[model samples]
Target: MLDVKDVTRMFGTKAAVDRVSFTVTGPAFVGIIGRSGAGKSTFLRMMNRLTDATFGQIMVDGTDILALRGAQARAWQSQCAMIFQQFNLVPRMDVASNVLHGILNRRSTMQTMFNLWPRADIIRALEILDRLGIAEQAPKRTEALSGGQQQRVAIARALMQDPKIILADEPIASLDPMNAQIVMDALKKINVEDGRMVIANLHTLDTARRYCDRVIGMRDGRIVFDGTPDQLSTGVARDIYGADASFNESATSTAIPTDATADRVYADAMLS
Candidate 1:
């Protein structure tokens, strides 16, 4: 379980994350939905100590995350892996090498600095790539892959950490509709099949509803709503995104197509 108690992050006088409190128990695919500068990214960063909270405590399981220092802090960060919007892969490196980098926290500094991974770690990286349906691309450079594939590689890298939680910060904001759905499906798979908690900062309402088991709506550095997808009605969405905001056609509707149909649509979209 993760407990966030009165967590707040202040930049000078401005509060980026304001006295937020929440508890997450068990594995869940959670989506943090908000418009730009709603403090969603800041909240997620604080969870992994990427950005320190000016006040309050974040306890993961029985340990206070804020109390960890040096090696312990690095270990804690490994357990709570993060995925970024930019993918963050080395453009020139092969996919396998990129995934293997996840084990750096567990490796000696000399070994990591020299890029010398053990055989077992190499095998594990390949397995993760296969599991993510991109094993064939292992030999290819990360920059050569499509946006969706690159994102999957990023996820594979996170999985290699064997993390207890995965925090994705607006992971699919750069992709097209097809790629977005694929990435969401991959995240949902991790949450369901691997039983890992996935907390993503989602840009679109439709993607959040399609994949997340729970949705957290944020507005101006505060959590406005927390509920299941079904509870997030149009009025609530309006409240979250603001009344004058315009959404895509699919955003208002919650009924998404089956996986097979979604793939077909993607194929067609690509062809067109």
Candidate 2:
């Protein structure tokens, strides 16, 4: 279980994350949606300790994550793997090597410095690539693969961590519609099949509705809505995005049924 209590992050006098509180128990595919600067990224970063909260406590299971230090803090971070919009990978390295990097934290300094991976770990990396449907690309350079394939390699890397939770920060922002669907499907498969929790900062509403079991809507720095996808009515979306917002651009652009007709269909589905 993950419990966030009165979490707030201040940058000088501005509060990026304002007294946010929520509890998550059991595995779930959670979508965090909001316009730019809604604190969605900040909140996820705080959970992984990439950004520190100015105040409040974050408890994962029975541990107060905010109080961890040094090696303990590093270990905590490893337990919560992060996937970025950029698909951070070593461009020059082979895909399999990039996936193996996930286990560096668990290895000795000399072993890591020498890039010495155990034979078992090498086989495990290959298995993960096969599971993600990218086994053939393992011997290729990471940068040589297409955007969608690279993202799958990134997912394979995260699996090497054996994380309790996966936090994806606007993971599909740079991909075209087809590639985006592939990435989202991969994420959903991870959550449903592996039973690991997935919390993604999503840009498109249709993607959220299609992939997430639970949706968390944020406005400014506060949670405006928290419920199942069916509860995310058009009225609720308007409240989340605002009255004059461009729905076609933000909500339907990368969505499935990507046609002019989908506009009304998406609107009706969201509103109904």
| Strongest candidate by lDDT | 2
Model 2 C-alpha lDDT per residue in residues 70-142, reported as the tens digit of each score: 9999999999999998999999999999999998888999998888999999999999999989999999999
Compose the digit string of candidate 1's lDDT tens values, residues 153-231.
9999999999999999988887776777777888899899999999999866666667888999988888899999767
Backbone clashes in model 2, listed as residue pairs: 234-270, 234-271
Give the worst 10-residue stretch by lDDT in candidate 2. 256-265
Which regions of candidate 2 fall more than 4 Å away from where they truly are?
A: 257-272
What's the number of clashes in each of the models? Answer: 0, 2
lDDT, candidate 2, at 136: 94
RMSD value for candidate 1: 5.4
Off by over 4 Å in 1: 246-272
